[model samples]
Target: MSRTVVFIHGLWIHSVAWQPWQELFAGKGYETHAPGWPGDKDTVAETRLHSEGAGVGVDEITDSYAKFIAGLDSPPIVVGHSFGGLIAQKLLDAGLATAAVAISPAPIKGIKILPLSLLRSSFPVLSRPGNRNKVVPLTEKQFAYGFGNALPPAESAELYERIAIPSPGRPLFEASSANFTKNAPTAVDTTRAGRGPLLLLAADEDHTVPAAVVAAAYRLYASSRARTDIIKYDDRGHSAAFDHGWRQLADDSLAWLDRQSL
Candidate 1:
């Protein structure tokens, strides 16, 4: 049978962020889906309005996604970025997905060393602890600086317009100060029998996730029974997935996935 694929978006981004990625995989014959997290609304306008008006926390969002996955009949090849990456790891640890790809995943338990880019990307949230309890939406300028710095102004603006949303402030807080342990909350149990393949794709110029930080996360999951691969995209920037010629990244992933027996 054909395998299923699931896309999990990072902080402040909804499942729609993966439409291009999903469509690419679909052309290659993988059924793909990206579920909306709890309190996450459709469109940039709705999410921005919601954040300014109400609040959604990390636990609430993750729990909502967990239920969504529990209902799926087929185990998917899950891919996630940033906070979504954290959730992807959790699902993999729980044996929910067949294989997983975590891109620029946030810092979790067992993921030590705070990359400066992570800190930079999160400056809007961690500028002060008080900000955590509040809903923080990125101002257009803020989005430009945090996520669009490496890309062209036009490309940055397009991305910002299409997907920028007010994300849970608490997730960033949690990542910042994880009470990390060997079997910590952020730790993924990759050794599960049913777990398939796992790839940790790091971008060398990715000031957002950084090569070293992703390297650490890869090492943590390398202990899995599932074969683990860490591939570095040198000269690729933080906006690697959305930048011009984004197909290169997608193409590379497809090549890697094809070689796997799973």
Candidate 2:
């Protein structure tokens, strides 16, 4: 049977963001799929114009991607970034993936550490309680501070223009309230017996999901019988997946996946 890999993008970006990763994995003889969140458009420009992604919540996004995974011939090696990372973990817990890699994942239920940078980065969405049902677009300054701080100004500006889009506030709200809410979509079933091995990848310079947050998440998963590990990049930021060193990150993940025999 042919092995498959599925890539999931985080908030403010579309499936197109994973195109390079898809091509790289495809070159390695793995069939790759990068599915967008429901109502996402093909291009950032179109998605920005439509802002349809803002209407959906985390549950809706996860359900939509779960359905796509179910149609696959075999459970895939799932890889995701930021919010997508949380979704990948959810899918793995649901037994939809053979193995999973979550890079700079959003805070899941039970992950209590929140760095000041993360709080600042998320303020645009969380500051406005009324934004739960509204679309929130990040300003260039916010994007630079949150995701592009590690990159050169020119490259950061280019990336901001190319990949940034409006994101729904509902998911952030759900994640924030997850600890108090029973069975929140942001909650992970870490103890699920058949769940696949998971890798929590982090970037030390990431303003959003900082190393501290990733370490706390790893501790939460440590109680599970399922295999879990972590990899941290000291020089990278939250946007490491799209930064100049992306190929190195991709190659490292491929090596890790090979060890799992996926």
Q: Which candidate is the best by lDDT?
A: 2
lDDT of 2 by residue, 69-126 (tens): 8898888988999999999999888888889999999998998887899999899999
Candidate 2 C-alpha error for residue 175, in Å: 0.9
* CA RMSD (A), model 1: 2.5
Give TM-scores for every candidate, taking all chains together and pairing residue i with residue i. 0.89, 0.97
Candidates' C-alpha lDDT: 0.73, 0.88
Screening candidate 2 with a backbone cut-off below 3 angstroms (N, C-alpha, C), the clashing residue pairs are none
Q: Number of clashes in model 2?
A: 0
